[model samples]
Target: MRHRLFEEGKATDCEEKIASLGRTPQEITQSLLNAEESLLNSLYECMRKDFELANGGGVSLPGYGTKGALALMAIYVAYKNGVGPFPKDLLDKLNEGRDSQHLRHIRREKGIRIAKHGRNEYHLEDLRLGKAFSNRHKGVEAATFAEIKAAYGYRCATCGAKEGELHHLPQYRESKEPVILHQGHMNPHEPLEAGNIIPQCQFCNRAYRNWVVFDRNGRVVGVSDWTFVLKSIRERYLRITEENRKIVQELISSLTTQLGQLGEGE
Candidate 1:
């Protein structure tokens, strides 16, 4: 059976070698778990550094970094520790422990309400208000869907669809007047802004459903593309401008730098 499993490529030669060395299955599993834990810690450190740089040197947890990053890390840790079927209370605890109370306060003062669903659950209304405020304050006109579509050459960031819609990052809530849409940072009512928006298809947009998406290797890619609902925004948007490009560049640089620093520290 072992030979067949190996022949079918289900088992690695390393596993056979470990068996020959007299390591039990439980021991092998433990070793793998340790390795995975080390890897996860390294990744977390890198993410921390990236967030710091992006935020102008240091960001409080739950306030900085992509929400997707934290969520994925929690899931990984739980799985590694033999925790199954993720519990709501544990998730809440993780979120609550990591979030930045200071940042939350600032957001509230700015007219951004942080909606709390449970002990560790929170949502920011006026999701893209930060970007909109910045652009408007910088004299950049509120871009229409057509403008954003033209900027990316009308291609969806995920599937590269030319016929899809423009998506608002940190999407604009329905209650906001005029419902400003397009690429922008999330939670204008809070600090840590810009490069929070991206063009996505309707399917990907709808898949978000208050949850962020992560790639197979555990890095956040963006919202999921399961539903294809973002197409609606494409019909009326315009192209991105040099100003927008600058904002994106800064954001990428900051995140990259922070991640690199964290990796080195780890």
Candidate 2:
């Protein structure tokens, strides 16, 4: 089937850069695939459903046989390859009948918490609706959010950028020493407690995911930032030095033992 692959301004800078390397078409394709393995993997995940269906004697190339599917793939490929979302001019020109307002609504509800009281029980009139409980996952109570806002002046605790999502820091797990430290293990399943929650903007929270910072003594002190990276390097150097000291001591002991044996022989 003959189909147009890329549209004007749809080519990403990364793709252009790779193509500019004076490489063959095959080489460029391989480079793009290698650089954007994750994007390709997600696309593959979508393709897999069709693949399974086809195996069961369903429609051949089911997902790939449509224009919409092709458009989505092209857009995602460009976006993941460093081209921003589909150009505004092109989108306006196409007049694809896609509702911009509805898209905004979807974006607004990206991480919003829907109130659920009991298991499989979501009642709008329920008093517990929209209330952030200590055991809830998705969101915190309004009161908890207020406390966070009051603590940080309604700004992001990390960079003071914006009053964003309710990020759960490491939860409180009982340590052997019974000493409560500031940083703890980040358990995703843990309840949303005030002490374990922080107000973080989307940028800071999503930038470096699961990025744990360690202190000189190997304790997780903060997020992955310049300070954390510097401390990690310093910690690595100290560990190497400690290992070298042990090696040097062992070598000296071996030499001393050999010298004593030679003296006895003489």
Candidate 3:
């Protein structure tokens, strides 16, 4: 309430001196969570389905299977426990590393709110459906997998990594080995194997899942430009900075009666 009042320029006129009702931080967090219990519950259900689709690999979003989903779940559960979600306690413990990049993308690009908690800690303030996750695991048939592998010279069509297990190529036929190739779709909306598949490494497949689809001959048949994404983020930053500059100017003017010039006297 106080924050809203401050934003509307009515905080100074409020009769209550301090805005807080003397609630503990935990109490406040619990209150916020309680207010949106139904929404968060539904979000967890969707995440569970996405996890099944991606399985152990990434899908839709980069590093999502390895990082983002688990981190967000941890953040969700942290609020349930009435505590802040620290990176080490939640993020690294699940994925063994900090996925700050994922967090930044979701917050800045997706417009999800992440509020800062006490002293360098943070919390997922609100839950928003950012993007649709589509990934039918093993959507490619086994026989087609072999055919695609052979077509790509038993190597990654994306990065040219050998199809066989690492450090066991050239004579890997002598011993039974697991193939490390993935049949990635060039067009996700098309049929699973309607001549729209390309063999890719796990890294490349995951990296280029939702963008940069290519043909078997290493030609980019499908494109999802990331330039627009960068441009939008840059535009948002500029808008926010301009609004902040105006707010700061107003605050300064209110604090002091001096009229300031952009360039002080030639």
Highest-scoring model, TM-score: 3
Residue-level lDDT of model 1, residues 130-220, one tens digit each, is 3212121221122555665565565554445445233243353232322222333222222322233444555444444334443211224
Per-residue alpha-carbon lDDT of model 2 for 122-163, expressed as tens digits? Answer: 111111112222322222234655665555566554544433
Candidate 2, lDDT over the whole model = 0.37
**Estimated TM-score for each candidate:** 0.20, 0.22, 0.28
Candidate 1 Cα outliers beyond 4 Å, as residue runs:
1-142, 164-194, 213-266
Clashes of 1: 29
Candidate structures ordered by lDDT, highest first: 3, 1, 2
Q: After superposition, how far is residue 39 of candidate 3 from its true place, in Å?
A: 74
* Candidate 2 lDDT score at position 248: 61
Tens-digit lDDT track for model 3 on 1-266?
22322345554422122122113344333332343545444445544443444344332333334456545655544443344455433344444533344554455444445565554456766443434323322223345678768766888766676765652344543545455787677766666683677777676676666666465444465555556345665888434476388876785686464434433543
Evaluated against the true structure, the overall lDDT of model 3 is: 0.50
Q: After superposition, how far is residue 211 of candidate 2 from its true place, in Å?
A: 3.1
